[model samples]
Target chain A: MKFKNFLYIIFLTTYYSFSQENNSSINGDFINNFQSYNDDPLIGAIAPEEKVLNNAYLNVIYTKNNFSIGLRYESYLNALMDFDSEFQGNGIPYRYITYTADGLEVTAGNYYEQFGSGLILRTYEDKGLGIDNAMDGIKLRLNPISGVYLKSFIGRSRTYFNYSEGIIRGVDMEMDINEMLRIENNGSYIFGSSIVSRFQEDNNPKFNLPQNVAAFSNRLNIMHSGFNYYIEYAYKFNDPVGSFSLESNNYAPGKALLSNLSYSKKGIGINIESHWIDHMEFRSERAKEKEFIINYIPTISKQHTYTLLALYPASTQMEGEFGVQADIFYKLKKGSLLGGKYGTKININFSKINAIKNGTSFLNDSLNIRSPFLSYDNDKLYFTDFNIEINKKLDKKTKINFIVSNQKYNKDILEGKTPGEYGTIQSTIGVVDISYKIKKGHTIRIESQALRSKPDPNATKKGDGHWVMLLSEYTISPNWFFSIQDMYNFGNYDQTQRLHYINATFGYIIGSNRFEIGYGKKRAGIFCVGGVCKEVPASNGLNINISSSF
Target chain B: MKRYLLFTILFFFLSQYIFSQEKLPNISVKNLNGKKVNIQDINNEGSPIVLNFWATWCKPCKLELNTIAEDYEDWQDETGVKIIAVSIDDSRSMSKVAPYINSVGWDYEIYLDPNRDLARSLGVSTVPHTFLLNEKKEIVWEHRGYIPGDEHKLLEKIESLVK
Candidate 1:
């Protein structure tokens, strides 16, 4: 009730003050996801007590000349499966007002921000992953000089309907070397530095902890011709916090280093990246989890699109990790022997991650898990992947894509499973997709995927057996689309465990409105977008989705 | 609380009556070469412009762009239109964008909005969102999702505008 009253006050003030502006515009978007569930014995899916679950969002933005006001209304009623139950009822969780003029901009209420590669600070929203960490506060951006940019913010990170206990404050500056020095060469250089600090009350009874924790990052970028090199190093002060996964209280200062080099031309591109991280997770509320995260360590692995290949996607560890990833993309010219009538595009990627060695043996309790730079434990491998993908146009009317992937996932280490419970999974995946345009305004696409796993006596349910999936989609001009897919665990030795997940869907799109409905069985697995991940439970259900913007 | 909610609903509807043409804001986005380019400074040479917000990992977005590529040259010749592809890929995937677009032979101008600042300002929460601008560079039409053969509808919209 208090929040409502506050908003009412802000709304009236803005409306009455801005009513005189004639060049005003209002825009918004709405999305709703509804699901109805059924009990599935084989997949271990039980219907929720409510039987139906839904999540909906509506965002409205009003803008006129140099001022804007926006708000987002969200309703979960009963949250969907795999969604945080804390998102209970409905409220306006995001609202902001902004004004900009003459190279100076100010935003108050709520905003998202990021600094150089997001190593020390990044706040964003990924609706698909149900992660929105927008900060509610005041932000100022200024470009007083041509080659210099400055930003500063002080706020509290959002956690559902509430805000984190800690207060976050950050400042960043970026300077362009060429513009600052008046150099005339085409080459480019930009240097940036950021400092982020969080303040929370120290309430622990057992140990003394710092009430204010600060982190700093320095970054540089060089771009000349087709080559680009970038790096950022971040260091965090001593912060004693809880690690939920390890079930331990940690007292350590954290640090991270990330670098990337890439070269791109008309027909080819190559990139190499490396990261060394240690206990660098910064959250607005130290004891809280994903909801209060204040920073993001950039992920380097290739995010696969195929179902089987994506099953073992890589993610960041909150404690310590070191990894390297590389990718190469090339295009075979048209009329060549391999390209045939059209050009062929090929991409190859490799990534590996390992745990960093802890320096606890030599350090005191206050800095217990601090490790030296770039040294990783040889035995604690986390994940590794190598994949190749090829896309080609067979003719004017048809296109095909092929992907082959190999991965080794350490389930025991990643999931924090104790000894004898699970083991590593060594698997290979292959996918083929073909899209054909029957004629103008009509198209059909078919995809097939296969995954084979090496047999191991200690394998767990996740490492069970081989799987195959097939999908077909048909579309009719500008408005309608239909698709069907089925995935089967064909290699399961136990007949009762061999289940087929089948689904079908159709969608209609008109201008800015989209409507989709589907009924299907969904297998339990980890769903990830970018580097963020979440576990989804198996279910059988009917889903309806609608979105519109105006 | 109910009264406040009711007031907001009424205000929202009342503001709907105040609609007017709005142009792109004066926000900065980086190009492939890492130089900042203000959104308001892009010049289309009096031709219609189409800005498509996309990401590297979105399948529908890729499909939409590829399908449009097949007729891009002809469409430009007919209506003098060009697409400016704005990528909303975050820090992790931003580098992959330049290579991906080049390897796929897309000639569209590519800009990076790593923090999604441009997208948020434009009220674009979904990928494959497309905006069509008139010769005056004012957004005249918008589309949220892409379906097969959507390019033809886009072309029709462009032709009517240019006519």
Candidate 2:
């Protein structure tokens, strides 16, 4: 860890020098344009109870014509999140220089890369999520010919505060069949394939794990007339581990398979996806903890958007599961009664997932010390949601939209807690959203939603009941806006526990700078961005903001 | 007719090039107080807008915003710029927006894109996915991650546009 920190600092210093030279044009304007604020003594010590320690970073990118190089300097005040204490000192987390010429791209030091669907091969980094699986090795991308592409890389996966001990390597090639085969005149069809393998020496005595593991996948996409279709299938080999079995003598690696199919045209679309896994647990380091898994298992459930509808979200169980999902979307064209003046869109989706049932039946005479693994059951342990939306032009100056949703969710598994030992719990939710344009530059939106669940043995006195919410926003054109919202817990669980959250805000826009102020009472909830979520602590206070570019 | 065809082809290519400029998708988000504002609606009105995703709990995010607050007025006057600061703060710190902004003295337009539905749709994986959109509502450029001094470069971009 000490060596890693030393190397990181050197990299940052070098990058800083490089950026100073390359970014000379912009640097001059920056220093001349903005004023710096004096450091506030309280800024560092007045840490909020719920907030992570403060960290700061500076990054500069200099691009001249087609060549660009960038560097980032980061300092973690006290080693935030899972960062090792060894790396507490301020330094550069990553600094890389790259150049692109024609269709070939090359990068040295650090970079992020991903292959089709990221199934088998992906080396992306997300600093906010504490995920940096970037390969610290050479990467080569070559479009040798007009229709064919090739990429290869050899490196080590980024480990906490350092690179992994194991060497990682992979190669990828994709051919645009339509262009490569010169069939563009007869419509277009594209086919591609990829294989990724990893090798790591194992010295642990508990099991004799295979050092070399490989996974492969194939993809196809076709477009003709007004319709388009895409499909991909992937499979991984077995690799046993301590987590899989307690019996030291009979352990074997696991296998997995996944596939997706979709078609779309004009105003109609359809999608179907399926996944099955025997024991495929892919991770950057097998010895690492479970939460540090680099790869992911796709869930078949639909991701909800509305506040109440998203109260319960399903997390993919990586161990063992088989599932399928289907979605359909259609729209009534403009001028039709259902479509109104603009158009009416209808969306329907459903998904189900359950453990794969093993075929072994219990024997009456057997005194087996080890129970057979549970097999998939006909019993449904999943969730489903349906919604419809109507969009219409009320008049020359006004437009309106309405949406309705109904959802059913599996509670026990999603929430990771249940009231009963073996029984499953289900929840139902509904929501309504409406937006109206009262006049030019003026609009208002309202949303009301609720959720109800069956009383569970573990439920707190509140029998499965209901919740209600009201939100309204009024925007006045060009310079000013205001909004108010309230979430009221009207459910049966505990009436007195029912809490109401309210907020009101105002904003002003001047030139390129926008200023806003607000006051409100908040609640605790998981805030998600692109499937990545963060825990936000509840607070009650005033807020102000100012921002501008250039 | 041939001339018309040529004109049509040129128009098609031009429009395609103009629209495919890597701009983030237009999304409606609520202000800190809960009013809905579409990102494109602001950018479409001939104002270059900076859309920054941030969180109250994120220390770096606070620093980045604070840094901007100190220089925002000059940036706006020189470049006809607007900053649409979108807070990803969840319910826990949702009410802290007004006081927080007031204390920081930032004069940027502040809105709360809570739940991050809009952020998800736009592939915003982290805070500080600062996007620079032109007057035509096209995303001209974007940078992921931020550090101190990076705002200076952002200002340079704005200056280039204004000039």
Q: List the residue pairs that clash in candidate 1.
A: none
For each candidate, give its TM-score against the true structure: 0.95, 0.65
lDDT (C-alpha) at residue B115 in model 2: 48
- Error in Å for residue A43 of model 2: 27
True contacts kept of each: 0.61, 0.00
For model 2, residues A1-550, the per-residue Cα lDDT tens digits are 3544344345434544565333221110010011112222321122244344434444433333234334444555554433344445455455455555776767676665555545566565444454556677777777787668777777777755567665666777777675666664635566667766677887767677777767776776665553345455665665544334443432333444565555555566666666665444556665565434445455555555567766655555555566767666566666888766655555566667775554112111123222134345556454455555444445444444455555544555444445343234456666666556565456666677777655445544333356677877676544566778787766646555566767787776433344567666555545443334444445555555443322
- What TM-score does each prediction get for chain A alone? 0.94, 0.76
Best by lDDT: 1
Which sections of candidate 1 miss by over 4 Å?
Answer: A1-21, A242-249, A359-369, A455-462
DockQ of 1: 0.62
